[model samples]
Target: MERNFMTTTKPFVIIGAGIAGVHAAESLRNEGYEGRIVLIDRDTQLPYDRPPLSKEYMLGESSESNIYLRSHESFNTLRIELKLGVEIVSIDAEKQIAITSDGTIIEWEKLLFTTGSRLRQLQVKGSDLEEVHYLKTLSDANNIRSKLDNVQQVVIVGAGFIGAELASSLKKLGKEVTILERMPLPLAHILGEEMGEYFLHLHQSKGVNVITGDSVVQFDGTSQVEKVLTENGRVISCQAVIVGIGVIPNTLLSDEKLDVDRGYVVNEFGETSLPNVYAAGDCAMWPYRGANIHIEHWDHAVNHGKCVAKNMINEKSAPYSAIPYFWSDQYDHRLQYFGHTKDWKSTVLRGNIEDQQFTYFYLNESDIVEAALLVNQPKNALAVRRLVKQQHPVHTDLLSNPDMSLKKVHLRANEDKVSY
Candidate 1:
């Protein structure tokens, strides 16, 4: 038997019309959900892809229409009521109603929060000056892109994926690019120090001035930023600056009644503590590998959205167990990563790093593959993903040999069962 809402006309409302929200709406309809579905967001523009905003979109290679997640006709065809430039001011969970910023009360049978995240702002002297931008939405990208023609020198205030991608794009645009990272090595937290050094060298070789172990203490200029002051007492002159330090989960809607940690706490099925409430994407921390983790990546968001939508309609859907995957494109190199591991005893290299074609495999004490990073080696992507999932023990000698394929290494079952 269907639920009570299935028999009525109450809409299934999803807050935040991002990738996750859009995917969830489509999944609901595809799963035979016949009720009214509404997707809401405070952003005035149509939902667009964010990853390209720092790359192709910034390089003037891709237009706004090309980046849009869906066209108007597509949403209309799916019967997904999209409410853009609309903000939900408050929610009455017991009453199953949400009050909008315009004082419109919308009743819903189930509520889904995919609010995503907000960029971490830089707070210091002259920070409020014009030309200091943070890229998160289409509007933010437009703001940065609009000023590129007048900008000859660009300073980026982070060495994370977005910041690095932006540096590559800006350098390609013929601007003198400078990157300021507080960490000793860029992306060391995720990619490790060795790979992080590789990125530092990659940027330096392209004529990008990368200054590590220093952070922006202040921005100097009148109405527009003309220079940046670092904590290490180094002053760098620049025409414009883009801050891509990181992002914090946008959980402003969560009240005392809702559970929230680093993000809105949700189970593997995307269920909250409250009945008929769900959360996904960057704003949700779901169970993974015996602990809850928030994976702020495009691929994870797409998968999580689809998985949650299934459980929203049918309560007995399978728990989400997809392996964590992420990719980044910088200059002419493509890096693909599969699985996640914070603790690994050894890292085995299979290919040449100096040639920029290699795969780094993270293995535990028992020689079980936990994660693998493929750089410019697209041919090994499928095999690497499968190897990580299988979690089979393999000889380091086989793994280190370039001729020994990953697919052939884990063929034999180990007498010792792998334990996490």
Candidate 2:
């Protein structure tokens, strides 16, 4: 929904002012690109990290200034031109021009569409109530905070990261929280039923109401949220609500010619169908291990931005093959995951899921470490990430033995070799 058209072609232009976009611009400068750079976004404020919005920022654990991507002085010193709060209406690849809602044309030799994603809107009734909210921007967090007063209980529709993190934050603030999820258990589809059950218990232990296999069909109130009606006819009374069903990648400017799958399709280099035109962050479905995936993880976004910036400057840059990783913070637990295993044949359970501190590894038919989730055992992630990246075989005994040296796991590959 957002950027400008320039008559004279600039050196580089980046769409979206989120983490990926800002990193791309900074990478370009770091790579010694002295030409003019333009960064555009719909936000009036400078680019700030989004991960904290649902956790630290919303809980008042972190301040706004602490989350800023970069200082204003740095941007000014780099001679970077920032066009904020502007909507890019359309882009004409034929003429290498982008038209903005502000009736301006900006042309660039290289254009990066790190356009990010828009929060998937709830289609149910009474979703437009003043008390209902979706967190995507700093303003959204602020608005949620502004309504915290007098809000006795809040109904959160989706138990994904955002909903889970926010639920934990709300509980800390002494607010009664109820989570409604259509999935059998929270994050079940992604983490499998076993680990999902662990999370279900994690929330239940925190005193927040966790309801699964049920969903909100509608909200009822007189110009304000009063109660949420579930599909099963159970009504949850609440003063406020937050919906985190999921998100749709912002691909309004993808155009007819560009390949658009679940997201804007891009190759290993992060280049779109159009040359010198790139897409990064959550908007691009990137190639990984003979598969195309749109990983909306914050770490993946930052890496994509950095890789794309390099490839945009020099065509011979290395292809991006980094394994996708993501983490979630809820209460006292920190859940960290490495690689993708959306479809795996076997899941090797390591550590104790009951204790809420463990590592679960996903293996294919051949027993390769395709993906892993470390529950409060992030110390085990580095080895898992390396193992997945190197495509090493997984011996259940090694993973099963908790006393085994995780740091020396990589050494097994070279233990028998002599350097004579």
Candidate 3:
């Protein structure tokens, strides 16, 4: 498709106002995009940070006020038309326009779909019972928190980050939390089975009742949820239930305009198959290395937004390449992971995890560190991130020594950057 018309100063429209969308809007203005910028989201609240919806905000350790991405004044100052509570039903790629739910026709020369992801709901019997909940928005979190006081026992389905964090939060609030996961161990698929066992340790030590390798088959109650039925015919009575199985890409509107393969297919520059129609964050499957990968990490969203924004304005697109990173907070433990394991074949253990402190490194066949994880060690997480960024081979003997400084990765970075 020809993008010759995209250079015009016509209005630019962004769908969804999550972290990726908000950052893209901010980046546009920062890159001297003085054109009319219209951002529409189904959410009424000014785009807010979502990570806290399952963490401190849900635990009452933090307030919703602190979770907002930007002040209302800033959006106004940037001349951004922030339209919330508006849903776009269809897109006309040929006409370069969008038809919203309320029959509003929005024309645009260029568009960005940062539609993000939505919760994959429970499809079991009696799943629609009142008191059974799913956390994806601030409103949902508020509803969950409002009922926490009266609820003593809660059943949480799935053991992903959201479920695990909520379980940790509820347990800290003096509520009994029973987590049910169909997988054998928590976070096994993402963090590896060995590290998955560590995640199990984190929640189990906190007194949260974790039931793995099983799923809730039914949420039973007359009106409000009072009991949960597992796939194995085990019955557990609880005052409420939280289903956090997973999420699906919110790409229904852009199906006709973009090629959908796992997610809206995008090049390394975040430009979709359609000219000037770019995608980023959770809804975009952008090229990494030689293949496309769909990432949902907060850091990836921020970086993708900034990179795509720059590419949108530049005459020549620059390939977006950045290592993925994300952190999880559970109880008193803070776990941080950097990079994805693909080329890596060997795992090196750094600290004594049995002693409640450790960092693991995933090394490729060439001995370059491909991924690093810091458990209960926030201070060293930055070092691992830098090591991944540098992509330099590590001296295994030194890296495995607990007494050796993690900062040694910096020296390796310097050596790798310099050519002989």
What total of clashing residue pairs does each candidate reach? 0, 10, 0
Across 248-323, the per-residue lDDT of candidate 1 in tens digits comes to: 8888886667999989999989998888999989899889878988889999889999899999999848589888
Writing each residue's lDDT as its tens digit, candidate 2 over 341-363 gives 78899987777777777888888
lDDT of 2: 0.87
Model 3 Cα lDDT, one tens digit per residue, 58-163: 8787887799998899999999889999888888888787787767678887889999987898899898889999999999999999988789999999999999
Model 1, position 49, has a per-residue lDDT of 92
Global Cα RMSD, each model: 3.8, 2.5, 3.6
Clashing pairs in 3: none
* lDDT leader: 1
RMSD of 3: 3.6
Supply the TM-score for candidate 2. 0.96
Query: Model 3 off-target regions past 4 Å?
Result: 1-9, 255-257, 409-420
TM-scores for the candidates: 0.96, 0.96, 0.94
Segments in model 2 whose C-alpha atoms lie over 4 Å from true places: 1-9, 413-420
* Candidate 1 regions with alpha-carbon error over 4 angstroms: 1-8, 413-420
